[model samples]
Target: MYSVVILANGLFPSTEKPLELLSQADKVVCCDGAAAKLLMWGREPDLIVGDMDSLSDSLKKRYSNIIKKCDGQEDNDLSKAFRSCLDYHPSSIHILGATGIREDHTLANVSLLAEYTELLKDIDCTVDIMTDSGVFYSGFESMQSYECKEGAEVSIFAFDNTLKMTCEGLKYQTDHVIFDSLWKASLNMAKSSKFVLKLNHPAKVIVFICND
Candidate 1:
């Protein structure tokens, strides 16, 4: 499927979920310092993208041929690595190590998922943030359903100022409601094997589903 996994320099994935993501990845791209952890794990990334400030000198030299220096302060290392993935025209992109450690960094990184999704909408590429605890999906206007284990924790966040949403198969169901805040939907439980979310109009939203 030409699935690519982008590794960020946040918290390293400690569970099987992240490892499963790596196993399904056709290519793994590390973001700057994240390559260090990948190296420690004895996994070599197909490409490395970032400012190179956090990358050690030895590692940089060793992977010089695959390193793509994007020394721009406007975009973080993760964003740079993500943009680089577009060149490959991947069918899907799974992001790992994008959360954990610094709370502010983690939030910012997660928020970027929407921006990346917007950029790839025309190409019909899917992007999801896979953390140690769960997976985060970004979607804009339309109905989406995800399969989850019964009783799994599911949270939805509005990335935009306003979103009209409806949900089913969750402990808390919303019926054609409008949300203006980012925390409008949070801490809901799955009631069945799957849950569905329907949105009206084009707007960014994040769906976080806990690992079984």
Candidate 2:
């Protein structure tokens, strides 16, 4: 089992529970300023990878053993951590300090997982981000519509071709629905089932999220 924890820049309140979640990590990798955050929690990262822009002389002196300096111009520490993940191929990677940021940064970081789609698929690894709202998207796959109540919202999006959606326990049911692009899909919470979702492109990565 591969386990890696990455620390990135994000909202303070958003990182409140990171310490708790990160405690279970076998190996922790602080990304740039993320070390500072881990330090605030009184924890030392197993390996801190970044451009060295975020480390301080004081923090470096304290956790010198694990720090692995890298060139920032090439990629962010987050990317470097990903490379490490590929090498180690951990069973799971819990990323902290990655949510509730500038829309561009948040979007970019979230989508960053897409870069490792092949690696992730090969290892069947799941990566989840600990956000203030909730834990989500450790990985992706084709899912079928199931029974759900009305007023329940399911956000569906695709990285490739359309995903076929069908449901049983829903106020509204689609026999063989197709979803593409950045469209929001949800349930009213009025129904549910093992609603089935068939993707025309099963190899594609699909996203399902709950707004409520």
**lDDT (CA) per prediction:** 0.87, 0.60
**Candidate no. 1 TM-score:** 0.92
Give candidate 2's TM-score: 0.73
lDDT of 1 by residue, 92-187 (tens): 999999999899998998889989988887996899999988999887758877888999999898855456678889998766445666567888
Q: After the best TM-score superposition of candidate 1, give how far the Cα of residue 135 lies from its true spot, in angstroms.
A: 0.4
User: Per-residue lDDT of 1-212 in model 2, one digit per residue for the tens?
Assistant: 66677767676433345566677777777776778877677777777777778788988887788777788576667788777655565788877777665677777776676565545777766676666554435234555333333445544444543555554444555444444444434332334423455544453333333423
Output the lDDT of residue 191, model 2: 45
Q: What is the TM-score of each candidate against the true structure?
A: 0.92, 0.73
Evaluated against the true structure, the overall lDDT of model 1 is 0.87
